[model samples]
Target: MATSNGFGPRALRYLESARNLVGCAGGAVGLGLHFAGLGGVWWPGVVAGLYGVGALLTPAPKPRPPLPPRPEPRPEPQPLPPEVSAPPAPKPEPVPAPEPAPAPDPELVALAAYLDTVPLPPSAGVDGLLAALRAAGPGPVAERIVRHRLPVAVAGYLRARTWQPWAGPDDPDPAVQLGREVDRLAGELA
Candidate 1:
């Protein structure tokens, strides 16, 4: 009729039954594995290991002792001396600001200008655009064009590119695929 700590006797009994069931299940599994030539003679050891771990984990009960009353310690007293204060020091001067960064390369500047001049339109069919990109030659610009058409073309490309999953958009951890999708979506939407 009595309870200890947080759990009642019924709960404790249920826990014991569950633990016994788990132990039996583990032993049966180990035995089966051993007979199947998977676990070998180590099956008994495995069972014993599980039981040992369970026994070590099981909580033991102890009687609660009475709490002792608290007594505060007395505070120490301080002696006063003659008052003598020193003057504060002067503040330091401000630091010099950093210089501006150098200009970008002329080739990079020209490329940026050229890219700016290029008209980006959603109505441009992906196939025609991709063909144009391929014809333009192999470079970052061509890669950028393919990246732009990814949302419309990537899924089909990926499916055909492999027998197994080619790290498609539907995949759980498709970081590169997701980036490509975003870039294409942004390009089309823009």
Candidate 2:
């Protein structure tokens, strides 16, 4: 049914659905028209303000009541014979306790954390560390990486993040240098 204004209920609802978008578009159009000598300089603002006011003045849409849940059709109970009994349910199997993981090496953990914060690719980061450990069996090579390479990589990463006054102008990008160092460590370990 059309209102006193001639807009049907559906048309009103459609407009109401996106009042803000309509208002902004109206404001833009009004501004363009004003510039083309159609209305006063206040036309755009008025158009936008009128929309806002209309939005505020309009009644909120009424929420529809929830649908009633469908009643499940239950089977009618039959009379049980006097002698029959229901079987007892089987007991559930007990779940085994999960084994705890070994504590990670402190240096490895620290290096992984730093790597995670930086933009270095996976192969240049923790994967490299794991690869080196696998190749070298964690003897001298692990010591060198843990004591030297990791610290240098972490320091380089930190330096890359901040302005470096002392860094030589010719130094390679930190990420490249870090990747190189990891590759070298893996090779040496291998």
Candidate 3:
């Protein structure tokens, strides 16, 4: 593996060969100088000189470059369907300002009061409640309550009432369901 710290195999081999050649030349020069009346001290100087030349000839290892910068990840824009992009339906026109919710009718109040006084079962079926409401002259309110409130109120009252009256396996008690239903519809009228 290539390393930043030093030369690899090829550079090492070249350096080794160059060092050996320089040492051989130094030995040859020292032998020649000794034969030519140069002393042992002169031979050491020749070897030192050859070593200096070898040091200069050896190449410097190149510096490794820094790693490249990492690329930034782009956020993927989701494609919205046409229906989702249609400006949120203009917030439903502010629900027509709710028309101020009409005040509860006096007749509805009296009817609701009357129903509250009556003792009725929590699990009364919707039909029997409608029948009782019809007998009480709230035929229209009875119809409305049965349509919207009866089922919801009966379910709620059955949940809250301590008395487990009139709820049966076959059929729920209609009279009590009618009373609870009337109470719920009256709340809307209020």
Best by lDDT: 2
Give the total clashing residue pairs for model 3.
Answer: 4
Candidate 1 wrongly placed segments (more than 4 Å): 1-5, 8-25, 28-83, 100-190
lDDT of 1 by residue, 19-111 (tens): 655656666766777788876667779767666565455465455897887888878755444464445577888788887554443443444
Candidate 3, residues 1-190, lDDT tens digits: the string is 7666565776766656755566567667766777787756677777667666765575655668999999999899887888776565545554455556445445545545554665555454333444455455435655566454654565565564544464556555455555655655555444
Question: How much is 72 displaced in model 1, in angstroms?
Answer: 19
Worst 10 residues of 3 by lDDT: 122-131
- The CA lDDT at 88 in model 1 is 54
- The predictions' CA RMSDs to the true structure, in order, are 18.7, 12.4, 25.7
- Per-prediction backbone clash count: 0, 0, 4
Score residue 44 of candidate 2 by CA lDDT.
58
Query: TM-score: which is higher, 1 or 3?
Result: 3
Tens digits of per-residue lDDT for model 2, 1-190: 6457555766777665755555556667666777888778777576677567655665666789999999999999996776785766799999998986645566666665765676655545657666556445446768787778767776876677565456688866666767787777767767
